[model samples]
Target: MQRRRLLPLLLAAALPLLGGPVAHAQAGRPIKLVVPYPPGGPLDAIARILAEKVQPTLGTVIVENRPGAGGNLGADAVAKAAPDGHSIVMGAVATHAINPWLYAKLPYDPVRDFAPITLVARVPNVLVLNVETADKLQIRSVADLVSYARKNPGRLNYGSGGNGSAGHLAGEMFKAQAKVSLVHIPYAGAAPAQLGLLGGQVDLNFDNLAAAAANIRAGKLKALAVTTAQRSAAMPELPTLAESGLPGLVVDTWFGLFAPARTPAESVQQLNAAFTAALNAPDVRERLAKFLAEPAPTSPAQFGDFVKAELAKYEKVVKASGVKLD
Candidate 1:
């Protein structure tokens, strides 16, 4: 009887140690960050940047590219993922904000389907025109572009990443604000849009600063103005749209990280902390600066608010632009 009592006590003593495996089970697994665009675009480039830096802190961050439907296809996957911390989408303005307004029926809700982590970075979209066209049209600044477009209404065409991309909305915003009639051309991605500008297929392209930085330096494309509240570091000499006579024409490509909805607040906090740290790292800052992107990290709650505000802001832009995708 004494031996049996001792055996029961030993079993009780082992229970705490046995809980280690159960705790490990609940510790979560590798996280998958889906990028809904093809490689080479600003979104994909930054996604890779975040992946390299964040994986070290996040245990295992697997970045998978799932490009389609102007970023909705991959984002849909993230929306349907389990509410654990195993999956997220490297969301951008196109995927998170503009798509909701452009598409009439979306498969997932931006606010309800995923939890915001942090805003990764923001890149100014620069107005780059074909060299020949810039010379022929006498377009040197935002005012010049507007005047020429207005003088030759419907003749000037502007290209964007896609129908619901930040570039498209920026152009639309420009149209509404400047009272100009430049035809909007939507490409599959920014790469194609860049090519269209170089090939003179499109009159101009509001492309990411990094993508067009090299071309601008080579004199292949003429950069009229950057579409940001402030000037871009890549080409500090270039003025902003607001400075070029169109005040309040600030449009930039903003990327953020998001986890599946219902992820524990603690986990979201941890992820945000890691991202914020990475953004502040000297190496990461330098790398972002090369692309003229500003590192922007914020608390999970703050990120959530930013997304909400962007959604509302873009909704009005989309309505004003009258861009509807079936």
Candidate 2:
């Protein structure tokens, strides 16, 4: 009789141990989705969109902004969270791939400390030249740009957000792969970098297509190519650098969902199903299209493999650049 009476109490305590979010979910607790950036960013907007989309299946998903240390703070919080589905992070390329090399001390192992749910989206970075500069230099395509850089050596310059930023690294990769010499100009952020390119202070820039779209449309910027494995749906007409000349010059500013490592496989699958379903929704697709983000939902295993590959790829790029941050 005593054993039977203790059974309920024991099970209740064991529930969390058995499954993190699974138990909390049964208890009507909402899942917490951490966005490691500012509130107005694309990641935050996507988190809110997916959260609402998945609420029908996963209950409430609270988006907590824990921005700091270039996304390390929020990712670490999720990495250290109980191996439950209740807490997950919208981790990106910086937090997963670049930070491992950029930051001397990362708070968590991006691969070992987290369980990948699914890749949410990939925002392709594009190579663009100032309209006047492109015309002046007679540079219209990647081939033209590379040829000019090769002939002119350090006469050409590209602007980026800062040292070790996506644009900077992309430029470094391009220089190495193309065997060209181009000076790098680091600006305060992407906006400043765009401004520099527009003002012709810089010859070119690798910026997100969405951010550069308005200028490109207004004829102020000439987009050469995108840096994605495939052409971005946002601008299918624009060729990828890989297609243009550099076959392996693929770079994407991507983000995905991740839970604490050792999370129950069942819970992970549940979360994946919910999120993937949300991503597949037509309405969600239309909304993400507006942001110029390409939704890419993958199985957990596939996402894990992709992350590992990205990590390995960036290791070489970061090491070659020799740029380190605290």
Candidate 1 wrong stretches, greater than 4 Å:
1-28, 40-42
Error of 2 at 133 (Å): 0.8
lDDT of 1: 0.83
Q: Name the TM-score of candidate 1.
A: 0.86
Best by TM-score: 2
The residue-level lDDT of candidate 2 at 224 comes to 90
**lDDT scores in order:** 0.83, 0.91
What local lDDT does model 2 show for residue 42? 82
